[model samples]
Target: MNILTAMSSRLTVPFLDLKSQYRQHQAAFDGAMGAVIAEAAFAGGPWVERFEAEFAAYCGTTYAVGVANGTVALWMVLLAMGIGPGDEVITVPSSFIATAEAISFCGAKPVFVDIQEADCNMDPGLLKAAISSRTKAIIPVHLFGHPANMEAILAIAQEHGLPVVEDAAQAHGARYDGKMAGSMGLAGCFSFHPVKNLGAFGEAGAVITNDGELAQKLQRLRDHGQFEKYQHEVIGWNGRMDGLQAAVLSTKLPFLEERNAQRRQRAGWYFEQLGGIPDLVLPASLPEVEHAWHQFPVRIPCRDAVFAAMQGAGIGCSIHYPVPIHRQKAYHFLGLPEGSFPVAERCSREFLSLPIFPELTEEQVRTVTRVLKLWITRNHRVKNIAFSGKLAV
Candidate 1:
């Protein structure tokens, strides 16, 4: 290929850098994999057990049960809470579909709530209005690694006698009032998908809790209802995490704090560089909360045009969810029409997530922020200025 072609090929940046990550822990990861393989304990074995224990400790929880993936971890938590048929799980619609899907899997309805405008998390102010006798639990997803207003949510949950299941999939180390994301709820679910802060080689997840009985129930729920082999007591699904994935996770676990710190640092750089860019709204941090920086998402006007320009510029910008869960075809049966969730729908159309990973260098962060600012200002500045003038009139 010519230099031009090579340059064009190199222009595209990945949203996450698995290569740099593996390179950083090549020897340890390889050794952990080798150990798991040599032990021939591939399923629900010693390695997985060790990983779960370590992860629970990391999350500051008493128990952690490894599952096949984030979705299963969520489902298991709801099920173990005895939440099923004729129940409703209240959650925000701005998050990944898995948050609602897990509730639906248990024959429960998902009550969509609006998010706080700045953080794109479930707005605590909207919680009370959504509560009903059918509301068995509240699942607040720490969207984009910013911890939700858990203090308010917990107070509401306590008042309503609702169990709180945290979707901590995007927030591994985020803190609210000094309490870790997972540790704030009755149970918290985490995803070890490759893009997450503590991502594994493949799919892995865990359900964490301080409640011993709830933890035991979730363990059985993940292991085909058998605490011991052939002693199945309840109908359960085989959602155990793979030994290989657990081994990889164990190898990477110690680096999670450092990785999250780097992500925060990169986000700070983006904030500093992109803070004053017209038409671009950066993510916000509350005075009492610390965001894990899972994704440095921002909302901007002319989102579609800005997205196109970024893609054309060979930048790796993407939307977390361009469509809200209420608008998804699978949930159409719920009968929520367009604009039913105005805030979430608006968020879907306007929010964009720039590339964020600990492996991203300062140069890459600057490049992404620079491209985004240039695109938005170039395309929309005239209209925005005109609108401002009109508002003055």
Candidate 2:
């Protein structure tokens, strides 16, 4: 067999393996389901309430409202905070579109900001310049599960009397200055999609806050605006979390810390192996914050070539975001040009998310690193590629 044929027939590594996780925890999951079924509370019942309390405590907050999904959690937070038409919500441009979509859903315009190249998080220095009389809220995303520079952002928000809603969608157990991710700001929103560190079986999200009034407002908004059942006092939407999802989350929450530790260990392995590979840029991990390696995303000059090479070698890799939010077609109405956020746009072209999860064995990490090194060594011609600004994987 020739080198080409041998390279064509290699072991396949998945981006994540939820099936194995489910099978490993099948008994515990079955017991959780049995209890949920026996209670017969399928939608926003005791099961949901129980999980809400547990999650709120986990986040070090006094209240948590379980919503249908992360996007709705953002919308509900905006609505509960009375952010709507004619108001502007400031956030970085590289986060999931849901960050902006939630603000748009509440009739608010999302103001874009450029991110620091090192962390891919909102640059706190740019906050003041972007603030105006119309600016009402600041939503800083903990991109890639690394906490945002909250101290700086909070200072700016406080000076301007603006509320902050942390988009902790990718950061479940992340921390900044010894504070948990969802415990900061007026409120912090989380997503429990299947890929998240503490994911539920299906879509699930929560809004955690120390402010009781905001928490109560969220509770009412996630329901039908009824402070009491069948007593609607204001407009609301059906954003309730299903009981089964809550059960799944309850079973999963107890394991978050342990799983997060495993992810961190895996990150260390990646750094140890991939360090100093030419043309590769590793994102920063602030010494003061705890990074919850949700996705091991790296920036390389020719990310498309690196990603394609990994795929062809039967290794699973992905692009965290092929297009920054400001450049997306849906957000074109914001009237922002391609170069509005240059750093974010450049990152969109070069960002690559490698396979990462608590379940990834050390051997898998080695294989991924080995493949990356081999590809980078074999193809040292990225400087001459003349690539497009966006490389969709």
Candidate 3:
């Protein structure tokens, strides 16, 4: 109950600490919750509607359709595109399982693509070769908050007359070439999971698109395939965003850009402190892109050992993904043989997500860098080391 007790209990650094965020916005959060409860508008209500409008404007899209979760957002976009059964969707193997889960649940197969070793995003140069006669859609993920090469991807899609779906689940406010993440694709799917840049208090998602017809159909798909209540025109699942989650999102939406700016500043600290280290490869800060930094992922030799040291020192750390999607037990049915996605597979072994939330203080950032330097000095192999696409030896 004392300040000392509170200070002592908090972790020196945490991967994410929503507790601080909630405390900072307690009044607005409480007000939002009270309004939702007072209205008894539990699902698909006014709050959700308001959030969709606000989010659409923020993302620079014509429409934003709220859904139950990020996975549902992706599925609705695909269903709205009329892509399923006998269709294959192209995406990277470096992403979370939800990307592929949405595809499989829609009765479509996921064709894997390698990522850019620098930004960990889908490599647009390799996209053309992955296309097939049955490739109904292309889902390019903005992995770890960096925007994908939207201009190149869009050109390729136009050439092939294929629709592009951006898995912007981790890149809420990221921008590429001055445009927002979700605005470049046919539909940009977002997750408002608690850890995302624009997180809701709980699970929530939205789909943003410029096409009026596709946006309209996506809205219908998320609400049991109805233009209105109890009037189903097509088969759809229960994917409506709840009023409570929407209320929370609306309360937080105003502060998202400010929070994102802080995350950027924190990431700069990482780059400044860790850059040019021969044994450690920092995440890429590519040109013409603004990263939202949902996860500050780095690649280093002896990644697991470094992760253990960080966590052991109460500096929370995790692997972005230790296993690629193609190598997972669930995807064995796809029969994507080993070495199918070399870049993503290599990243799986090396990518370590460092704690880089807006709530993290500058001193905490310094502390993290200090510990990392100590560990890397002791364990990393510096012989003929290359970093950030250049030789460091």
Per lDDT, the best of the predicted structures is 2
lDDT of 1: 0.86
Write one digit per residue (lDDT tens) for candidate 1, span 114-214: 99886788999999999998999999999899999999999999998888989999999899999989888899999999888889888999998999999
Which rank order by lDDT, best down to worst? Answer: 2, 3, 1
Tens-place lDDT per residue, model 3, 304-347, is 76676677567888898999999999999888888988989889
Clashing pairs in 3: none
What lDDT does the true structure give each of the candidates? 0.86, 0.88, 0.87
Off by over 4 Å in 3: 1-11, 380-393
Instruction: Go through the candidates in order and give the clash count of each.
Output: 0, 0, 0
Report how far residue 391 has shifted in candidate 2, in Å.
19
Model 2 per-residue lDDT tens digits across residues 318-341: 897999998899998879998889
- lDDT against true structure, model 3: 0.87
